[model samples]
Target: MKVMIRKDSKGTLSAYVPKKDLEEPIVSIARPQMWGGLVTLANGWRLELPEMAADTALPITVEARRVAGGED
Candidate 1:
């Protein structure tokens, strides 16, 4: 899935799922620190997702990391 990360007027960082609209984000990072690094979601899904360019009009493709003991 291609994810879109954008900054709101209040400066909150949010990730937009293509299927869903920007008004509702797939996940919202606590801070910008998670932008370039690996992030573990509340549901325990870890992703090697990275932030893309602000000026770019492309969505990013992310792969969800396999859980330690979970089936692929």
Candidate 2:
């Protein structure tokens, strides 16, 4: 699925799923830089993000795979 990753004014990370019309704050990340690893959302959805540069800009949409804890 396509997920948009961004940081709010307060610098909180979040993921938005366009198809589902859902947006949730990212609660935890498997990798410190938050790429090529899994991110856990506040709603309990786990998404596997693609590999990207450490300095990749935010509010960017990227392809990610849903790994666990969400409805199809």
- Candidate 2 per-residue lDDT over residues 1-72, each given as its tens digit: 999999999999999999999999999999887999999999889999999999999999999999966545
lDDT, each prediction: 0.45, 0.93
Clashes of 1: 0
Candidate 2, which segments miss by more than 4 Å at Cα?
Answer: 69-72
- The C-alpha TM-scores of every prediction are 0.41, 0.93
Give Cα distance to truth, residue 17, candidate 1, Å: 0.5
- Could you say which candidate leads in TM-score? 2
> RMSD in angstroms, candidate 2?
1.4
Q: What is the C-alpha RMSD of each candidate to the true structure, in Å?
A: 5.9, 1.4
Error of 1 at 49 (Å): 1.5
lDDT of 1 by residue, 36-71 (tens): 555544344444565545344434344433235311
Residue 58 shift from truth in candidate 1, angstroms: 11
